[model samples]
Target: MPLLESLVKRRKNREPLSYITGKAEFFKRQFSVDERVLIPRPESEQLVAQTINYVRKLGIEHPRIADIGTGSGAIAISIALEMPSAEVFATDISSEALKVAQMNAHKLGAEVEFTQGNLMGTLQGKFDLIVSNPPYIQSQVIKSLEPEVLREPRIALDGGPNGTEVISPLLEEIRKKLKPSYSAAYVEIDPPIADIALKTAQAKFSYAEVSILTDLAGLIRCISIENN
Candidate 1:
């Protein structure tokens, strides 16, 4: 009852529920969370699950994977936990977020190599799967977001005027670095922007197919791009 009361109070005051509870569940596991990192959303779990399924379908064992803009290491760590043979690299631009992610990874006994960098800039080599839940909310829209979302780091939420600042750059970089060796890529985005994302992916890669996956709310919450 005391916990519930605290959560209610926090929510009423615009605090993120995860911040009040200090934990969030993703991929059937609880992860530590705070204002320092964006709370892991259920939609992201779908992205992880889809990515895992796609990789397994390709019969690729011990694949190398990279999770760009890894906030709490949810995406990367979840993959590592499911596919022990996968070499997972989790990168973020904020050191504070990385610290939280590192601690979460350690606490969960997930072997994820965490790094601090803007998107895939510091990453090297090719990956069988590259995934990201980058900031997709436009700057102006962020101000109008629910109080809970406003509590997260602005760097992790604001995606410039069009909500594609980080995403555009990340996609461009991925296109440049992606090789025939890599099999698939997955990304999470706002449902309203799914068309723009699909168009961008199509324009960037020839053998890419963008499939929108709906969340429990029936919104197009995740975009999976399979590249040849």
Candidate 2:
């Protein structure tokens, strides 16, 4: 009963239940999470599902996959576990977040290579699939977030003046890192920025198939760019 009271006290303080429990479920698996990382969301699981579906559809026996801004290793580990034949790599700018990601990967027994870097800047070679759930929240709006969300690491939320700060640079870098043929990138974004995200993706990959994907709620949630 005392422990329950302590949990209730933490909840009253607006701390995320995931943080208090030290775990968050994603893609039907549990991942370790804390203040150092953003809790994995359901929308990101859709991103992973799409990636896996694409890889299977392409019939790639051994695809090279990269997950950027891999908070808590949710997306990376999920993909790695589902598609064990694929070579999975995950990157994050924060070493602290990477530690959480690494721990999750280790605990989940998912074979993922975790690296500390900004987006895809540190990854080498081309990837068959590039996925990211980056910081797309407007910097000014972050302060207005719910208390539980505010407790998440600020660096994992701030996206400069506009919501596309990190998304813009990430798309720019992907052009060089993504395979020229039979490759795609899936980036999660807030619904409000769907138009901007679509435009940015189309501008970056004019010859490729660029489109906005909606989540279960029918709200725009991801921008998908497929190379021809």
Candidate 3:
């Protein structure tokens, strides 16, 4: 089959458009993506934007930043490129996804330290900022999703029961990684259970403030946690 024909066939067979094109964009920058990682979505841009703004407001020169579950290196790489002074790290549970993320960091010429481990497992020491866009879809909802979305890796979508399986645990792990004060985490959350995720984060960081942020659609899109 001709190359374009093969590409069209793949899309017709329900391959994600990003996988077919071998690219996805976040924060106005393009990235290479495949079955190993989740496609970067526009709504996630809100997380990135808010993080950058918070970092600037904090005015902490050379802030240490980490991107949890940084599939495709979208969030980490973008922030590294945007904040030349900040040290950046990215982690993923899938080695394959890390390979793609590393490749993207090189292609984009962004300096991001990469680690392979589940959630906060590979991380040590404190970071001034941490951000993530983890799996948030309930198992049952995932089963009923469109074939196009289903084409993505299940690990990147399955949030287990109540859609808080990953997010809830991650909040506790995140609190431990933070720098205690003036540290914050920006998390991209699915709207369906944003409240649940925020509550969990707050519970984990009782001294911290967890706020829900909305995207242009006025739907819950992110949870910002700042430890005052």
List, residue by residue over 46-156, the lDDT tens digit for candidate 2: 889999989989899999999999989999999999999999999999999999999988999999998998888789999999999999998889889999999999988
Candidate 1 residues 1-228, lDDT tens each?
998887788789988778988899998999999889999987788778877887788888888889999989988999999999999998999999999999999999999998888888888888888889998887888878887777889888887887787777788887766556447788888766778887787777767766777878788886677864
- Clashing pairs counted in every model: 0, 0, 0
**Higher-ranked by lDDT: 1 or 2:** 2
Model 2: CA > 4 A from native: none
Count of clashes in candidate 1: 0
Residues 131-173, candidate 3: write the lDDT tens digits.
9999999888997998989888899999998998888888888
The TM-score measured for candidate 1 stands at: 0.92
Residue 151 Cα positional deviation in candidate 3, in Å, after optimal superposition: 0.7
Residue 40's lDDT in candidate 3: 88
Q: What does the lDDT come to for candidate 2?
A: 0.92
Worst 10 residues of 3 by lDDT: 43-52
Worst 10 residues of 2 by lDDT: 190-199
- The true-versus-predicted C-alpha distance at residue 80 of model 3, in Å, is 0.3
